[model samples]
Target: MKNIYKGLILSLLVLGVGLAGCSNDDNNPSPDGKDYASLDDKLDYSLARNEVDFLMETYEKDADRKYHDAELPTKFTEEQNVFMQNALTINLNHSAPVVVLPMLRGIDGNGEKVYYIITEASDFKMAKKLGVNYSPKLKYARGSEGVQKATVNGDGYMVFEGSVDFSPVRRIEPGTGEFAFPPSVAQPGAVGDENYSPIVVLPSNLVLNATPVKNVTGLHDRIPEGERSLDLDEMWVTLQILDGFQGGRAYYYHLVTDAYDQVPATIELGIYAPKLGKIPQFGQSTLDEESALLGFSPVGNGIDDLQSDNRQGLSSAILSDQNGSGSLAPLDPINVFPIEPQNELEKNNNYSPLWDAHISKWTDEAIEKGYQRRITSFQDLKSLVDKGWVVSFTPDAGPVNSYVAGLNASNAIINCPVIAHPKN
Candidate 1:
């Protein structure tokens, strides 16, 4: 009887192990599943209505086609399907880290330009926003620079940028205890990432250029009063963004100087909504407003921790998150392009400090966010081609410089990417 009992217990343990394995099998699916399946269906076009309207206006005179679901009426026709397939092939040439040309492009039958477009920015969603230009446009000042955060997308704030140390300061502040700079904010970088070190600096327009002096305050009227060379010197002007009511706006960053004139090879600019003043420059955001289609989170979580090893349940996490709806978790994809040489502006201005390492993407929580990563093992040149909604092109070929130009034109500090994203 004792021997029989022992054998029965061993059998039960084996059954338990088998059940656990089956459960994991049921849970796991490949990453990029939805994105791949959507591509296969060829009907998941999501170009925005306004963009569609623009396209329609551009090609309405032609009698060759109809329109349905914001697509050319004959979008499913054989010729149209061929064109779409070709466009997808071009887009999916998956050689890019951030999915180059994240949209569909084609020519209308009338020989007019027809773009199956996606909106990098749109005003349709309430409280949606983007930067226009640098403001308070100061050249000189004292202490703390630039403004950020605080719902500055609507009509009550002004977008401002200021210069600081040109060298990238990775450890922004020592001993993490809330931030010292108020009215201004910057996104926190990982403890260690081959990060963009930006010294916060004052903008060229803020104050008159002054030599490094001692004990000076930004936006103060007394700097001109002193004649001594050693009194409160000005070095880096704190950059700031003004937010709040038009008449009562306050400067979030106190716009001052870093104790010297010499800055660094790189710099970080601050953007924010200051307390209101005479003129309202930027807008306000609220829970009442809809969510941004884009998202921003540590790429390591999605791109590194998850994609690199397919560790634990990472791929399954991506699939489940992108099942359909959206969440605002930090795991969103921010677009990033590897800084390449031979670019004119990067060479001349050398202003990489102004760029963020990650561009924001369509946001959702960890549970709802699925990774849309594409990896390929290339043994040859042609292997660099892109696949699906992911396309990559090498600048060496023709330097489709237009791609860079489009990025500049959008002035997109970062674009939030969408998973199973709708076009617009």
Candidate 2:
């Protein structure tokens, strides 16, 4: 009996040792020999509202300044990182970087209260300091009824002449064709009045794009629990809670789609333009200096190429059917621009809101050989382009005898901030 007891104790000790070894190995490698780590493991997600409060306080103090051309930090700071993490947690499924800005309340032509978020400030320093992109070209958007004028009040809040109506039911139906190039009908949920444009000129001659986020009040109660998404036609809205000096305050964060980047090419589909003159430069930093971060070669003399209404920038890239039917269809009117930053290093070094645009078409031999398929990655697209299975072109020079895609001009400017790139 004594011998049996001793033997059992030894067996248990050996089992425990084996289990410990296995647990440690599990952390280092998987069956496929890939080391996996959760986002939580790599990042600290502790909430820090004081950081945001400090930044906002600084911005308010400098609000009355006439010019803000001072150099600002380009890289993310500790405060910015904290705010980004908290904002990203509101919706983990977001495809683009989530930017959270302070909402300015105003009464529209109607007596109801509306909220707007500022993106591009005409002052390059102010724009960078606020963590938003700069657009000196917004100065030209003034004088149009499409552009709304606003004044910063004593409380540092914006007072606008009119507001956007976000209660419209947004819908889009793709055409019955295999590619569904042009949607049978498409409508954005939010619409501004005749006086409303995304561009807002301030009292200090500072022009900025103030995009509408929410119009109706009490819509928060309608959102389901554990679900933060409130789809508004093409745009999405999510509520965020911040613990500031004023205590807990709720703000709305808007998620807008970005122009899909196809390596050396950029493709744009939509925009909110009340008139041709109201179209602001999509990703430019200043009027004279092109963005060092975003590589782009404009189609014509800058924004002038898009002035004509007849230009319909459509690409011949066929959308492949998901069910393996191998049917081809025309793409929607997409404004393609030639871009640089061909590799990950260039992308990381000078990452800008501006994306390079390219038009890709499958070659006749590729389609005949069944080598044409949907591209899954930047590498795959480049590989096909190299093998002559696919041919790429500038917006000005498309495939021979093809239908005229739209003009090589940007039609849309999505307010999406890039957070991180995937390591594949």
Candidate 3:
């Protein structure tokens, strides 16, 4: 009897040990299941806003390091950082622009959870806050079938679990005080999209300038939630890419963008919008209703409220190759369409759209300075040198003379001031 009882106890202990080992195997993850080496503790996503806060902090760090790098454009400093951080830390996502870069897996908006982090920080960490606002938020994919699991982050600091898509985020420009934008937004849409363009430029001389861009008041009295548009008189820039371009080196044209209705339209004038960065679009022109130009179309919807005061803006660039060949050619009516190769200026044919009044005034000034004869268009401005006038072309550091030249009482115009040949 004693032997039988001892044997039974031993057998039961063995069975218990086997069962515990099997359970452990099923519950524990395999080595290949995770890449925890580069992972930080999975974001402390225990609270409602915690996820957003964490992301915001992460982006703040990235942008701070990126822009403040001593060797680079060291444009934003510590003080500016504070201003940017505060401005960007927002309860209202629509009124501000935000961009997000995630290291998460299986959660992306259009593609690999990444974006071009364009921002302006005077210190409030605008870029980071923006990233948090725009990046993945755990939302349900518009249409989901049953039994579907929505996990925002397959890994740390990752995705917006519920939905694969969300609203489009606007690209932030420090100079432009604009906020939210739709994703399908056309290329030139934000940068002076003839339709939804903002007022970015103002004239150097006010006499001939157009009114700055403005918004229609009483359009429902107040702006709705999730609508991020700029307020009038705020300095902003138009972001654009021309028809032919490689990569997204977007051009930033600065403007006050408020005039039109206010301009006591004495005569139609050009508005001056300066470039804050490199203007990637090589050649430029103001299109007439009948002409086709490669650049932005002047056609837009909110002309009633937002108006660009056409005046000359200030810009400068070194013209690479200047083969002084005195030549006069007829304006190709075909240029009525956008810039095609055939319409490219012949070797010495330089032309810009300028008001007759402006040309007459400048020509008179040169004559007053004891010049032999007057030059005609902007190309003529360059030709003054060969014709015996001091046709001086100097590399400039600040604004384009167009500020003075383009300014009308209501407008300013900044056409291509630089005839730079592409640097190889």
Q: Give me the candidate number with maximum TM-score.
A: 2
The root-mean-square deviation over C-alpha atoms between each candidate and the true structure, in angstroms, is 28.9, 22.0, 25.1
Clashes of each: 105, 13, 83
Residue 80's lDDT within candidate 2 is 33
Model 1 agreement with the true structure over 1-424: per-residue lDDT tens digits: 9657534533432222221222211132211122212111111011112223332332222323322122223222332111111111112111221111111222221222212222111111100111111111111111222211111111111112221111222122111222111112122211101111112111111111111111111121112222331111221121111110111111111111121101000011121112101111111111121211111111212233434433221122232222211121111122233221111121121111122111111123322546334221111111212212222211122212122221111111221111111111
Question: Candidate 1, 256: how far from true, in Å?
Answer: 32
Task: Name the lDDT value of residue 77 in candidate 1.
Answer: 38
TM match of model 1 to true structure: 0.20
Query: Would you estimate the TM-scores of all the predictions?
Result: 0.20, 0.47, 0.19
Query: What lDDT score is found at residue 272 in candidate 1?
Result: 16
lDDT of each: 0.19, 0.35, 0.20
Q: Candidate 2, TM-score vs. the true structure?
A: 0.47
- List runs of model 3 lying over 4 Å from the truth: 1-46, 56-83, 86-107, 116-154, 158-424
Of 1 and 3, which scores higher on lDDT?
3
Error of 1 at 137 (Å): 28
List ranges where model 1 is wrong by over 4 Å.
1-295, 299-413, 417-424
Model 3: weakest 10-residue lDDT segment is 313-322
Q: What ranking of all candidate models by lDDT puts the best one first?
A: 2, 3, 1
Please give, for residues 302-412, the per-residue lDDT of candidate 3 as tens digits. 111111211111100000001111011111000011111211222221122111111112233444574422122344433443344432121131222231122111122
- Once fitted onto the true fold, the runs of candidate 2 whose alpha carbons sit more than 4 angstroms away are 1-101, 137-146, 217-277, 280-407, 410-424
The Cα RMSD of model 2 versus the native structure comes to: 22.0
